[model samples]
Target chain A: MAVSQRALEAAGLGGGRGRLERLRQWREQEHVFGYGLILPALVLLTCLVAYPFGMAIYFSLSDYWVGSPGQFVGLTNYREILGNDVFRQTVQNSFVFTGFALTLKTLLGVWLAVLLARDVRFKRVLRGAVLLPWVIPTALSTLGWWWMFDSLYSVVNWTAIRLGLISAPGPNWLGQTNYAMAAVIIVNVWRGLPFFAITVLAGLMSIPREFYEAAEVDGASSRQRFWHVTLPLLKPVLAVVILFSTIFTFSDFNIVQILTRGGPVNTTHLFATLAYQIGLQGGNLGQGAAISLFLFPMLAMVVFLQLRYIRRD
Target chain B: MASAASVRARRLRAALTYANLTPFVFFALFPFYFMFVTSFKRNAELYNLKAVPFWIQTGAITDHYDFLFRRTEFLIWMKNSLIVSVIAMSISLVIAILAGYSLARLRYRGVGSFGTAVFITYLVPPTLLFLPLSQVVNWLGLSDSIWALVVTYPTFLVPFSTWLLMGYFRTVPREVEECALVDGASRLQTLLRIVLPMAVPGVVCAALFGFTLCWNEFIYALTFVSQSGNKTAVVGVTADLIRGDIYYWGSLMAGAVLASVPIVVIYVWFLDYYVSGLTAGAVKG
Candidate 1:
């Protein structure tokens, strides 16, 4: 009974204690300190990300431009964008571009990661070399690609001709619709493949070697071992990587903007570049806001799925 | 006989693997190689149909480098990029260290949801936010200033740094902090004195990633800063180099090469941390 009473006093659970009151006060201070520590980050995030997100949605519904105040005009901007031919084409183009680029990146990333995980000679050098496209800024690297794909001075064409692969100058890459799309997608894959390879390689490294050893001892072939042990273990990491990459690829701006600038009859305009065109350049802020918001629903679905997966873990 | 056939098959498989890897390696490195080679090529060599495209002509000229330095605002852009990247990185590290420590160590309500919120914000790509963010920048009267990029970059950087740091902080043994607490150390002192020193690699990783991100930022820098002197390398190179119907290929290549050198050097120096930091966030998240 005495020990219980003393413990209560120490915790300030008993009324009107001296040192125990100071202890309670210190605990309260710590509680407030937690909030204080998070306050700056929270405030900054609200101003930069959260507030802008809300304004983007509001701007989508208003007739806001660069210089003029906007009037609320619900669904008008969305309807027009949905109905417009350029916007429609861009919507299709964004999907195609993201889909093809991501598919290729995933395949190549897995293959590269598998190779990298092996005990190859000069492995560190090879890994560093492979990551060059990713570490360099996309805009700068894409510029190099732009020069390489120049209609008249294309290096690719010169090499192809020398190798007897083509008899004539290569087609203008960014001047044609399909070729423009292909060029942008190619650059996107090149830059993005390293991300997948590195992340998947990390995933591959985390799997216990004993699992592979056990499988081999059970008479499993390399292919069978990969299917049974590696794929299942890699699924979680792959899910997270794919989800993140999809969101990124869908919102990609630099690659398209730098390479194609939504050129060749606007066949390469993703949501971002199209928004930049209409909002900033064309002075139609409301419409641009709406166009950018088109990505929101799709990405929100992805974020929701990702959150659920993370929570389950 | 079976063993010999299997050995031959393995050899063949190894050859095929190398064959598959060769093209990918070539594709990955070719653009950079082309950029370097073309940067040094004389304008005459660049235009000549008879010259080989892959190799630079003997006694290649540095006229493009001369042009980039003398005729363009390349140096000013480099300074601007350095200034903005450093400021943004410092601010991001400070905020992320506090926020990450709080989320990872402090006992508090709503930390789980708060951490998730930060992750979700990270997921909110800059593309969706840039339009409204531009308006906000205008409102702050920061457009056309390096401060615009310095302030805006933290939106992406803080969340990423915090997320990475949170993972790092979690890996730290909790008993160390508890012992400090028992020794009558405040949380702040403990974090600064004890935890931070132990977490140097994590902090360095965060700093490197954050700095590289700020250096690489494009769309905001492109949109917010239009003045020639204020533009960063990526934006300036794209805008000023390509005149309509006349691509200054050599100078553009030189500019690209110059812009990439600092980042490439950093990547080479910190390759392991770069790879692990990148993958740790994804795998952990």
Candidate 2:
């Protein structure tokens, strides 16, 4: 009784404390509705994301063909995949695709971002124009490129030959293994640059003008200012953008599958497409899942490290 | 004079800017220009190995568009895409607003931490999730329907939209809501009557993003829908153009151009939303 009385006196609720406590409780409940609002979104996320992800991991370890019962394989598939040449090549190709695409996208994105940052006439139109490739459905725009590169109907070849730039007629772009891969990479870089540009542009705009003015006052050259001022300030957002693009480019199936579908003797096969062939098309679910699951550990480690970096502020 | 020297320096800077931009402009514009010119050529003209095939030679060809529309399920595919994108956008945005409001304003235990965790979940690549998702779709018996996309898109869309809105909601002043609360309004009423009106720009941004995501998604649509009538615009164009052994180049280009039109229109309409939403919090940070 003494403790309650003391607490009431401290809170200024000793007299008519019951009514005061009820009003406070009601106010607290009212604010708690904020928590109540997120319930539906959480339910949807769990159902569609969390549950499916758990199922994918579970099925990756099992020898489950699509229509048949799954059996525990106990790393047997993983062991076999380690010995497979095609799977190894697919892994290598995925790395090459991601590596080359990331390098190109970042470089080009930075270049374009620098240009767009200048005070120019009709900059908005150019920015919007640049985003068209990124915005259009990957399959559709890639198909447009595919038709442009088709040996039989290639306007590029026809124009080149007619202009006397080449002696012979249309070159086989898709048929040649090397050219096919290069074409896909080029298309991927083209589509990705705008997104990188937009992101980097946002980053550039965010930087305070005071920094540049200070650098100018100190007689810093343009290159030095960019290297020291722009680069360091843009680091966090750039890290997020690059990490996103790397993960995306690594697992990209649409551009490759649309353009080549691992064609001309599987020269362009990446891990994701190979998984699709094995699991869905070729009907070897266990192997396909195993191939798809191959990149998970590496990605998880990288992403885990990145998450730490992002949270370390 | 020092003024003349400064003028020369200004010109030098301008020249340097031009030099830096040349490669980027050419690289960005060339292929699209190539596509635009190529789509106008007949098969014979395209095969002729000619320099600068005038796209509007005798007449700007309308045959490809006609053929694509008449010969394939292009119209139906377009309709399906519109339906799915609209429905998905509407559902995700509605859910996102409620969820975002709760997370931003509510002081429940774990709410702050949970908001960050949810945003991270949005970054989970659809590539990794699509395999198990196929099985989930099979279980739900929504295989080969546009409805499958509508159902699954929110898995990804809701997270990002909610996250985006949460950031936006944080900017809205708390006093406005407190004023509403003092006037005998409930939380829901305050959100609808007061908060949403002020948050229209943010809501529009979320809606635009949701719409674009649903419209452009290809992997899931390709994986899920195989039927001729139900395939979304992306799948329909690709599959129809390369049906069996034959590749119809003209019609495919036509379909590509047509498919891009709606996106262009949407972007133009909501240019402000794209700019603001895209640059949201970036400048401040």
Candidate 3:
């Protein structure tokens, strides 16, 4: 009680103790205090996230353009995009891009993380080296990839030819249909690999050494130990990494935009690049918003299911 | 002895790890090296069909770097990126610190739901919101300006840094905070003076990580700002440096290298904190 009185006094609430104390007491309640604390974040999100999201949905439903806000057509934009061949191809491209990129990143990421977890010399340097692609700006780094895949004076082709990996004048990476998708996927994997490896490495480091030793005592081979022990423990971390990476990969713009610009006949456009083309560049805001929001439902469901899965533990 | 064989096995495993790591490391690093090498080489060496592509046989030149600064607004773009990143990061950090503390420590109604909402917001990519946000930016008269980014970047940064800092704040001992409160400190004072100092690492981690995200942000930067003066470094290089069919390979690469080097240097200084921040967010978050 004395401490409470002193605290109130220190808060400059001694005079008019009745109302002041009551007000202080009211504000001091955990619920009110908590709300007050989070109020700034709440305001920022409501204005920036929630409000814009609502606007995005509205834009998708209406026949809006950059200059003119058209009347609401009620799913006409969605229907129109669903009927468009470019949009259809983009849908297919998004899945193929996300699917391949995620698979490669997962496989290579886990393998790299395992290698990183070893007690090797200069471990920090090696880890930093591996993370270069991830830490550098994506648009900037993708520009480098664009150069390497340049049709003329291509280093990738030069090296490949030197090593007998491919014949003279290799497939035009960004220009060809199949290789355009392949090029985007390769860059995506390269960029995403460090994220997976480092996050999973953290998971790997967290596992008790005794568990591995106990498995070893049971005569489990190295592969068996990884299968039974490391894999199970790494699931949550992997899930979180994959969940985030999936969203990032699906909405990837910088790689496709800078490298291909959804080019080679739009064979490599993801939802973002397609949305940018249709909405921003094409001035069809309604269709663009519709296309971009196309993945929101799927992503939300993934987040919902994955959150529940994580919360189970 | 079995011990000798075990040592041999371990050495072999170490050797194998190195061998496997070599290819991945090369894939990660070769691009940067190529970019750097390309940036310095003259047009003669850069365009030469016969010259070796791996390294420059001809001497390096600053012609590209000279062009980047002299002919283009590379410096201005970099300045925009720096300003946007620092200001946005500072704002998000302050907001995140408050929300993280409340979510982590306070016993409140709907706190759980609020926590989940923040996490979900982190999942909402800018691509989905950019169309509406472009309008919103225009509505507020911030379009074609750095203020547009300063205003919207927080939509993503706040949620992520808030969630991460919640995990960080939860690790801070409640007893210390309580002690401060009992001694006549107000709640706000306690948070600012007592709790914040202890979470310095988390704060630094959040700042460095958030700054990098801001610097690296592309789509919003590309879409929101269009004028040459207002563009961020990443967008400026891609948008301006590549004119027509004639590729400015040397200057474009110079721009890429210059844009990437600042982030690379910052990460090097705080690499462990970056990892620790991730572990906290991934494992605890």
Of the true interface contacts, each candidate retains a share of 0.75, 0.52, 0.87
Candidate 2 lDDT at A311 equals 65
Chain A TM-score relative to the true structure, per candidate: 0.90, 0.85, 0.92
Q: Write the per-residue lDDT of candidate 1 for residues B1-285, one digit (tens) a residue.
A: 999999998888777777777888999999999999999988888888889889987668889999999999999999999999999999999999999988888877888888888989889889998999999999999989999999999999999999999989888898998899789876777889989988888899999999899999999999999899999988898888886657489899999999988899899999999888898777787
The two-chain DockQ for each candidate, comma-separated, is 0.67, 0.44, 0.82
lDDT of 3 by residue, B161-230 (tens): 9988887787789999999989988788888999899989989989988999999999999999999999
TM-score of 3: 0.96
Highest DockQ among the candidates is held by which one? 3
Output the lDDT of residue A295, model 3.
78
B1-285: candidate 2 lDDT, tens digit per residue: 999999998888777877777666666666656656656666555555433454645446767788887788888988999999999999999999999888877787888666766766766777777777877888899988999999999888888788778778888899999999899776778889998888888898988878888888988898888888999887888776765554356677778778767887898788767766665622221
Residue ranges of candidate 2 with Cα displaced over 4 Å? A1-32, A152-171, B51-58, B244-247, B279-285
The local lDDT score (0 to 100) that residue B236 gets in candidate 1 is 90
Could you tell me which 10 consecutive residues in candidate 2 chain A have the lowest summed lDDT?
A: A23-32
Ordered from best to worst DockQ, the candidate numbers read: 3, 1, 2
Give the B-chain TM-score of model 2: 0.92
How should the candidates be ordered by TM-score, best one leading? 3, 1, 2
**TM-score of model number 2:** 0.89
Task: List, residue by residue over A150-201, the lDDT tens digit for candidate 2.
Answer: 7775656766777899866656888888888888899899889988888899
